[model samples]
Target: MNTWQQAALAAEIENQAQVPVLSLAASASVRPSRRLGRPTLIQMGSNIYEQVRCISAIVRSYHWRGVIAIYEDDAYGGNAEMLTLFSEALQRVGSEIEYHLSLPPISSLSDPRESVYQELLKLLSTQSRVFIVLQSSLPMATHLFQEARRMDFMGKDSAWIITDSISSFLDSMDTSVIPYMEGALGIKSYYSKSNRPFLEFSAQFQKNFKSENPEENNTQPGIHALRADDSIAVIARALERLASDDTNTPKMMLKNILARNFSGLSGNIIFEGGDLSNSNSLLFRIINVVRTGYKELDFWTQDLDNPFRREGRDKNSSRNTTKVLDGPVIWPGYLIKRVPKGWEMPTDAKPLKIGIPAKTSFDKFVKVDEAEAEADKRYSGFCIDIFREVLKILEQNYSLPYEFHPVIGTYDELVDFVYNKVITPISSL
Candidate 1:
C-alpha cells in the first residue's frame, strides 16, 4: 500500500461512515468482526445476450476467423454457459470459435519463469491476429500483451478487444504500455448511466441522511463506500419489504434473495434465472488511458434516453449537482488525462506521490467473513459477475468488442503513475 487521499466521492462517503459498507476483499486479515445476517446475491443487470450478438455481427462483418484467447474457468471460462449461448448465435453467420485457451490467473503468472505464459505463446504461435482478451484483471491480460510485445505483435492494423471487467484496470495501468496497447479496445457495462435514477437515488439518500456534504469542483456526485449503489438500492428495497413481512432470520433473508425480483435504482434487479441478467450489460468505447485514474472514454453503451437533470444544479447555484450521500462514490483517483492546461502544480511542492489506501475499501457486495457459519452470507459480490455477463451480452448481441485482462500493478504504484503523468485525466466524453 502507498500514501493516499480520497477523491471527491471518497470524501463524500467518509463524511457518512455510519451507513453499512459494501465488502469485496478476499483476505483473512480484512474480514469484519461483526457478521451480516443477509445472504449474498449474484448481481444480474447487464445484458449479455445483446453483447454476444454485437460481437457476432462484428466477426461476420469483418469476415475474419482468428483464434480467441480466453481467461480462466470460472463464470468467464472459455467454453462456459455464456459461450454456449454465443456459439449458437455465431453459428448462424458461418463464423465459429477457432480456439478457446484460458489464460492463467495473475498470481500464477507473477513469475516470468512460470508456465502460464507458455500456453499463450502456443496460442499466438498459430499466428492469431484478432484476439479477444477475457481476463478480468489487466495485469494478467498485460502478460499476454507482454508476450505479444516480446514476439513483436503490434502493427499498423492490429485490433484487439476486451470485456468490461478489465476496463477499470486501465484507470491505474502503466502508461509505458500505452504506445504498445493504444489500439486496445474495451466493452463497458455502465459508462454515464449515472444519470437521473442514480442522481435521484443519491438525492434521496442524502435527504434521508442529514449529514450530506456540498458538491466539489472538478467532480461528480456520489456517496462513498457503496460499490455501485445499485446493490445497496436493491438491498435497501428488499429490507423495506422484509421489514414489512417481519422476517429477519437468515433463512428468510436467503429465501427473500432467491424468491424475489427487485427493482433497484441501477436497473431491474435480477439474479441468474430471472429476466434480469448481467448478460444484459451495455458496451462503452475506450480509446486512450486517462492518466492513472479511471479510463475516461466516450460512452457508447445504451443509456436511459430520458436523463433527469438536478433542478438547482446550475453553475450559479451554490450547490450545483454534487452531494455526499449514503457512502463513498468510487470516483477515478487517477484519470487518463493530466491536470487542466491552465492549472500549474503547487509551487515549492514536489510532484505528488501516489499512496495506497490506509484502510482497504470494499466495493463488492460479497461477504468475506470466514468464521460466519452461514454459507449463504460468505462470498459477497456478484457485481463483477454481472458485469462479466453484461459485457458478454454486448459481445453476443450488439457486436461491440468485449475484452478482459488482470489487475497487475500495486494500488500505490498506480496512484504514483497517475500523479506523475503515467496516465491521462478522466472525462465524461
Candidate 2:
C-alpha cells in the first residue's frame, strides 16, 4: 500500500482497483468514498457540517444578515464542499452569503494574479463586514490577515471567522501573524480537555514521541496523530475479529470496523456508513485573537439558535446547559468592551423602508390610511404600536431613519420582500 499526505490518494487507490483503503484524515471527500462502497473505503474525523455550525453561530450572534466567503480552490479535498455545507448552515441560522471568493492553492500563491493579498484588497472594498475564511494553509492565512491589517479592514465593525484547519494550526503558528489576527474569531474542533482518557493518552503519546524523536523540538501530538492512533486501534480490533471468521473478506472486515464504536485518544469514535457518526455531532471551540495570542471566547454546538456558550465549562455538560461568553471582548484596533455590529449603512444610505402588510380583514392590526396623501404613507394599528417600541430600542444603538411603506400583498409576499431585501421587516424594527 502507498501512503501520501494528499487526500486525493484515497480516490487514486480506488482508481487502481486495489485493496480496501481507510482515511485517517477527514479531508477525504465523501462522494469518492461512497463510490468505492462503504465497506471498501472509510473516512475518519469530523465532517464539514459539524464544523460549520460554530462559524454560522458567530455570524448569527452578531445578527449579521450577510457574509462573504473566501475559500481555497483545490479539487482533491478543498473548500467547495465545505462552502456548500457552510452556506446551508448559515441559511439555517437566518443568514445569507453576499459573495464567495476563491483563492488558489498555496502552491499557486507565488503567482501575483492568484495571490491572496490581491483578493484581500477586493474584499476590503466590499460592504459585507463578516467574512468566513476557509483556507487550509496557515501561511496563506497569515498573509491574508496581514494584508487585511494593512488595508485597515480589521475594525470593530468587521468580523473574520476561520475554520478548524487554521484554528489547530494556530497553536504552533508564528508570533508575527498574531498581531495581524487581532479581534479575529475561529471555529475549531473541540476535544474534551477534561476527558481523563484523552489527557492520559496525550501525555503518554508526548513522552513516547519525544523518546522516538530525540532531536525534535516540539513533541506535541496533532490531530493527525490522534487519527493515526484511532486507525491503528481500529486495525487491531479488526485483526482480532478476523481471527474468528476465515470467510470474512477484507470488505466484511472493513464493514465490521465501521460498525464498531469505541473510545479513543480523540474522544468517542464511531462511523455512520462511510462518514462519521453525525455530521452535526462535532463540538467546536470559539476563540478570539489578541495581542498575546488567542483566547477562548465561547463554545458552539449543533443547536444553531443557542450555539455559543460561555467558558467555565464542564466537558460532560450539555450544550443547552452552557451560557454565552463570560466578559467583554477586545475588538480590532485594540478597542475594548464592544461587539462588532457586523454591518453599516451604505454610502448611499436611505431610510429603512419598512414593509407593512396591508390587510382588509385585520384593519385594526395594520390600517394603511391611503386617504392621507403623504410621501411616507400613514399607518396606525396595534401592530404598528408594537413595531414602534422595537424601533425605539434600535434607535439606542443605530440610526432609525425609517419610513413605513404599505405593501398590498399577501403574507407570503411580505416575507419574500424581507427575504429578498426589498424592504426591512417592521417586525425587526
Candidate 3:
C-alpha cells in the first residue's frame, strides 16, 4: 500500500464499485493520470508543487547557489518526482543540486541508524553544506538527524531545510528527537487555529484522544488529522449536494466535491484538476526548530507578490530585501546569531596543485625555472605576477592553499592533464 502502483490499483477497484475515491496521498506521483480522461481519484492533500516553490524561494532569499538533496528511495515514485520538481525549482532561482543522497524507505530498512550513518559519511566528502530533505518518514528522519549531529554535520556552517512530509508530524515525535534537529528549518502547511470551529474541534479531539489512549503523552492532533477532518467535511457536503440530484452516481458525487470552496479545519477546501488547488488560501509557514519545539518564522502564500516577507509587515521593508525571516535564529551547536555559509572545505583536503608549462616560446608572458627538487621549482612572468596578486586578494576571504608545479609537456598536453585530474588546474605561467 506504500507504493503508488498499489494505490492506483485500489482506486481503480473502488471506481469499478461505483464508489468515489478521495486519496490522502500528498505526493505528485499519486495524482490521477489525465490521459485516461476524467479522474476517478481525487487527492485531498496539499499540493506538492506549492511546497517546492516555497522552498525554492527560501533558498533564493538566502542566496544559496548550490544545495544537496536527501530523500527517501521508495517504490511509490513520490520522492523521486519531488526531487525532480525541487531540482527544477532551484534552477529557476539560480541554484543547482550539487548531489543527491538516497536513503532506503523506512519500511524496507532494518537498521535505519546504521544506514543513515553510512549516508552521512558520504556527505562529509562533499563541499555543499546546504541540504534539502524531501519525502522522509518520521523514523528515517529521526535517525538521519541523530546521525548528522553525532557526525558534526550539524554545525554553524550547515543549513538543513525539510519539506512538509516530516514537518507535519513533528509533534508526534519524541521530545528527545527535537534536540537532534535543532537549527533545522521546516515548511509546514498553514491553518488558522484561532477560529472558533477549529478550537472546538481541537478541544473535543484532545478529550477523545486521551480517553482512547491513556499511554500517549502528546494528544494534540497534527496536520494530517486536521486534513482528515476537512476531507470528511468535504465528503459530507458533497453527499448533501448529491441528494438534490435524482441520479446519485459516483461521477456526480465527484463533481460536487470538486465544486466545494469553503474554510475548514485545515484551511479552505478547494479542488482543481482533482487535487487541492494552490490558491491564496493555501499557505505554508516556515519554522525553525528550537529547544522547546519550533518557532514560526514566516509564511509563504500565492497571494503575496513578495512571499518572503513576514506577515503584517510592509512589503517594501528594508529587512525583507536581505533577510527572509524577521526573527533571529539559533544555529546548530547553540551558536547564537550566526548564519551558516552553506559550504566548507573538508578538513583533510589537500592543497591545490597548479600546473605550469616548463617550456614556452614567449618567456616574458610565461617562464619556469627548473630545479633538482621539484618542490623548489620557481615560476615567474607577467602571468605569474597577475595570478599571485589575484590569489592574495582571494586569500583575504578564503584559505586557498595552492602550490605550483612545472610540467614538461606541450600546451595541449598540459590542458589534457588538468582535464584528466592529473593536476588540479593549469595556468599559462
Model 2 lDDT per residue over 255-293, tens place? 668777787766677776565554334477778778766
Give the winner by TM-score. Answer: 3
**Per-residue lDDT of 253 in model 1:** 49
lDDT of each: 0.41, 0.67, 0.75
Query: Which tens-of-lDDT digit does each residue in 73-102 have in candidate 1?
Result: 332232364566556656765666656776
Model 1 misplacement above 4 A: 1-41, 45-50, 73-79, 109-117, 171-180, 191-228, 254-265, 268-429
**Candidate 3 minimal-lDDT segment of 10 residues:** 29-38
User: Which ten-residue region of model 2 has the weakest summed lDDT?
Assistant: 1-10
Quote the positional error of residue 179 for candidate 1 in Å.
4.6
Instruction: Please give the TM-score that candidate 1 achieves against the real structure.
Output: 0.47
In angstroms, the error of model 1 at 428 is 62
> For residues 1-429, could you state the per-residue lDDT of candidate 3 as single tens digits?
433445556777776655666666565542443433337666666667778888888888888888999987776555667777888888888888888999987788788888888888888666678988876778888899988889988888889998888888776556667888999999888887789988899899889988987776666777888988988889999989999999888878878988988988887777777777655543888899887678888877664346664666664542342455666877776766767888875233656667778788898877887653564336778988888899899888878777777677788988787645564334433
Itemize residue pairs with steric clashes in candidate 3: none
